[model samples]
Target: MKFSPLLAELINALTCLPGVGNKSAQRMAFHLLERNREGALSLSNVLHNAMEHITHCQRCRTFTEDEVCEICRHPEREASGLLCIVESPQDVLAIEQTLSYKGQYFVLMGHLSPIDGIGPDEIGLDKLESRLQEGRISEVILATNPTVEGEATAHYIAQLCANASVDASRIAHGVPVGGELEYIDGNTLTHAFSGRRKV
Candidate 1:
């Protein structure tokens, strides 16, 4: 039997999420329509609000509703002068969960992927260069993923730090090669963040 047009459209929309295939989308759509229209409505409202309100923080480039994120505005974090650079905003959250780092962050939003046409400018490197030129940061800890593109991005940023007379380091312990920082366990990530080696 064919699903009604609206139900089919809902299922198709649900499939847009990563890892949610047709069967999963159909299951979710049916579950929402069958058992929890109220929950679905609530989810829809919250998602709509977040999509409309959430934006990148001005200084760190992390997702926030404000012009500057709380972390960037914190006095202690600013005084610390330590900057941790990551490939994505999710990485910032992952490192925060480890509770081993208390410093400023620069979220690239993506790595340097030439094949995909993503470059330094596309990932907010110009803004990062402006921040580095400010001379407020003393060191930059490269917390980008262990992938090839991540490494390349890190090295490129390290050069920028060098140009700005800031120390640069790469996270060097516990994190496995080729693994994403977002997926690493908190303890391992903590160790990696704490054991960063000078680049």
Candidate 2:
């Protein structure tokens, strides 16, 4: 029952993905190897290319190749008095699928987890503050998840924005309590954005 070094390495690499344990990684490796070499190659190529091109947007921390994301640079999007703040790029994607929002987005990239040593600056709150100071945005919608950490992070950001004189609000109801935005349906996400409550 000895495997080649190459196969072992493949399993180890697959395990690097979040939630992929040793057994799952081994299963994936064997499944990919047994079915399609081209699929595995395609996955590798895409991962490498994405790693090279995907970078944080200067304005919003959302992943993009350019300085600003398509959402931020789009002229059709509402330029004044609107903003949606979320915890990660996936959350942004989830909301985008709803097709109800036509405003800019600011991705926090993470929640405030003090035990994990993640603080405000580490999550780029200062950058957000600077963006607020630019004096064009009037309403900021905090779209962070409904978890404890996410709520705390939203409250912290809302307080910061309020102190700087920007109107802030949290995502409206419809998003389930103790649920993450990624799992929410498109219609629900859209409804949440439209019905956001002032904080």
Q: Using lDDT as the measure, which candidate wins? A: 1
lDDT per residue (tens digit) for residues 1-199 in model 2: 6679999999999988999999999999999999988999999999999999989998889888887888888876646568899989999989999988888998888999999999999899999899889888898999999788998999998898888899998866588889898999987788788887789
| lDDT for position 60 in model 1 | 87
- Residue pairs clashing in model 2 are none
TM-score of each model, paired residue for residue: 0.85, 0.81
Q: Could you give candidate 1's per-residue lDDT for residues 1-199 as a string of tens digits?
A: 8899888899999998999999999999989989999999999999999999999999988999999999999999999999999988889889999898889999989999999999889999999999999989999999899778998999999998989898999977588889998999898888887887889
Q: What are the lDDT scores of the predictions, listed in order?
A: 0.92, 0.89
Instruction: Give candidate 2 regions above 4 Å deviation.
Output: 174-199
Model 2, residue 58: distance off in Å is: 0.9
By how many angstroms RMSD does model 1 differ from the true structure?
Answer: 5.9
Candidate 1 local distance difference test against the native: 0.92
